[model samples]
Every structure is written in C-alpha cells, then in structure tokens.
Target: MVSDTEILAFFRGELSRQVNRKLQTVPLELETLLQDYAPADELPYVISDYSNKYGVDVSALDMRNYFPWENLPLTTRLFKGRNFRASVIANRKPLTVKMFAESARAGRWLYD
Candidate 1:
C-alpha cells in the first residue's frame, strides 16, 4: 500500500487543481464516532471514512477516492477475458419505529 503522506499529497494536489480547493488530510483517531447504520472494519475498505476525520473537500461520492479496488469480480466468464460482479453497498436502515410505521402503512407486499 502507498504511504499516507503520498495519498494526502495526491489528494491535496488534485483537489487544488481540479476544484480550486485545498484538501485536508488528517490521521484517524480513536475518538471518531460511527453511525448505527454504518459498519466499521468491513473490508474493500473505504475512503469516505476519512472526510469525517479530515474535513477534506471530497465526499463519498468522489469515485477517484471511493472506488472499490478490492471488490473486483472473483470469477471470470467461460472462455472469455472478462470479470465483473454486482455489489450493493447501502446504509443499513434496520427496522426502526418510523420505518416500521411506514411499512405498516404501506402494507407488507407478500406474494403468498
């Protein structure tokens, strides 16, 4: 893996050039808080976790940063040179009172 300073500098330079903004990169600390909808330690790692810590101009939507390099397809097509996979990374909206109420209002659409 590349050094943190290199990553910081790259972000700094790119942001400065591309968006006319300065990039702020900070070291991750233990005091950082996580939302109930978010999971920590999940791999394919992530870049968004940094914005909350660094206050950088970039957010999770920046594909240059959040691109899931480790999530590449593990399987290839037969007799072809292609590899792909569909993965969904979403905020876990585990049933809360508000959501449960909305679902009840909508009625559970069960086929049976």
Candidate 2:
C-alpha cells in the first residue's frame, strides 16, 4: 500500500519539477492546492500521470470541477463583468495533494 508520506513526496517532487520551483523544506500537506503548483492547462495531465503512476482510478474525476478554463478572451472577460468572473472563481473546487494521496491509498477517486 502507498503511504501518505510517499504520495506527498511524489507530488512535491513532480510539481516542483514541472513548475521549475524549489522544493519546500516542509512536506506538502493534504490541503495544499494542486493548482498553485502548476499552470491550469497542465493540471489535468499532472493528475492523470499521478493516477497512472500510482494505479489510482480517476474515471470519476472531472477536471473542470477543479480548474477553471484557461483564461477567457479579453472581450469575454470584459463583457462578463466582475460578477461573472467572481462566480467562476468561486465555483472552482480546489484540487489538493491530499485528495490524490487518499485516492491512491483507496485505489480509486474519492472526491467529487
């Protein structure tokens, strides 16, 4: 079975590498938002890779729920106004390193 520590280490290393960021001396926690570690466009692939590497089933995982679409066009943003933008941001459910770790331990996706 994969331990949470192992899962945290994997994410910390993988995300740090992908983002070209330095590793934190402290290990990433369950609440650590995955989006903060990588660009929105890259998050899906990162999650997919993690799922595959650890044999976690991710068929139920929806990327849209966790990530907003890569930036809207300027025209759309302007027309949408502050409320629309705020709603979109508010609706995003944070995908965290802990969720992945839990799913890995369970051998399936655990979050909606």
Candidate 3:
C-alpha cells in the first residue's frame, strides 16, 4: 500500500524543486502537479468569496476543483480547501498553494 506520507513526501520534493528552480508556471500546470498529492476525485473545492464577509458567490468559481494544495493534512488528513475570489487570482495567474489555502481558510469557504 502506498502510504500517504510517501505520497506527501514525493509531492513535497516536487514542490520544493519547482520553488528552488524558480520555475514560472500557470494555474493549469500547477493543477497538473497537484494530482500527485490529491486523488482525482478527492481534490478540494475552491470556493470564491469576493468580500471578506458573509457572502460567497458560488455561481462563480474560478477553478473547478482547485483548492490550495499546501493546506493538505498529513496526519489527520482533514483539510478544508477553500479560497476567496480576488481579481488577480480569479483571473489567469499563477496559483500558489499557500495563497489559495490561506484565502480559502480565511474566507471560510470550506463550509460551502
């Protein structure tokens, strides 16, 4: 059985490599690498909260199933991937796992 730790490790290495290499990529490419960590059907939902308050425009989601990959839970494996929809990020920009996770958690989009 492939342990989750192993999976996480491999992904961690890959992410580190990308960072170390200073590689520039689009959200689509990041979406591709994200597969190493999350199962096809298991990717977290990326909700959009235009404002920082009680309102989520579920009707307009940028990424189909794009959650912040960095917010992954290695132990309990319980990550509520959520992100806000900002003008820059919502557009076609390079996606960061950290930013996505932080935005999602802050916006409380996971509940949706």
Candidate 4:
C-alpha cells in the first residue's frame, strides 16, 4: 500500500494541488479523525438496509473498490450501512472502508 506521502507526491504536479497537499500538513489528530472513515462491508442484507438508509436504488451503486490480491468481488453490498450483528450471524468477513476506496482509485473496481 502507498503511504500518504507517496499519494501526495503523485498529486504534486497540479495547479489544484492544495487539496491533496493539505493531508500531509494536517495534525496527526485531525488526520486520524478523517481517516476513521469506513466502508459498509459488514452490513448483512444490504439490499434492504440501503433501502432504509438512502431510499435510492442500492443496485445503482456501481462505484466500489476491491483488492485484486484478495479476489474479493466488486460489490454494492459493501456500501449500504452497518450490520455488524447480521454479519456475525452470517459469518462474513469484514472489510475496511479504506481498502474499498483505495481499490476504486487504483482501478481494481469500476462503476457501471
């Protein structure tokens, strides 16, 4: 995985670089806060949970990240919402939100 510094370096040659550059300058506490973001992978019965959360078509969610090395499917199921209990009941593996976004950025997954 690329470190935050390397990601910033990749975005350095642009006029609108401040957005990406700002991550590097942020205080550790603030960085940790933002990095706490997570994807919705553990949600069991996502097809229904998403209906309750967004009211939009969950199937419409095509933008997803997947780790090629893990052979995980690019899925909308991971973006619905939290269902930790259901996941436990179903015996599903949990995936972090960060990995999902990174996968999309790296083109391991694609939206329709």
Question: For this target, which candidate reaches the highest TM-score against the unseen true structure?
Answer: 2
Cα lDDT computed for each candidate against the true fold: 0.29, 0.76, 0.35, 0.33
Candidate 3 lDDT trough over 10 residues, lowest sum: 45-54
Question: Number of the top candidate by lDDT?
Answer: 2
Candidate 4 lDDT over residue span 13-89, tens digit each: 21121233447532222123211222233332432442343243445333232222123433533553356334532
Alpha-carbon RMSD, candidate 2: 3.7
Which 10-residue window of candidate 1 scores lowest in summed lDDT? 29-38
Candidate 4: list runs displaced more than 4 Å. Answer: 1-48, 62-64, 72-112
Candidate 2 per-residue lDDT over residues 1-112, each given as its tens digit: 8887888887776664432346435445768777655667666677788988999899999777776644567787778788888788787888888788788989999998
RMSD of each: 16.7, 3.7, 16.4, 14.4
Model 1's alpha-carbon lDDT is 0.29
Tell me the tens digit of each residue's lDDT in model 1 across 1-112: 3344543443333231222135544322222221222233331133333333343333223231223322335443323243322232232222212321222233431111
Candidate number that wins on TM-score, 2 or 3:
2
Would you estimate the TM-scores of all the predictions?
0.20, 0.76, 0.23, 0.21
Give the per-residue Cα lDDT of candidate 2 at 18.
Answer: 39
lDDT, residue 91, candidate 1: 23
lDDT score for residue 1 of model 4: 49
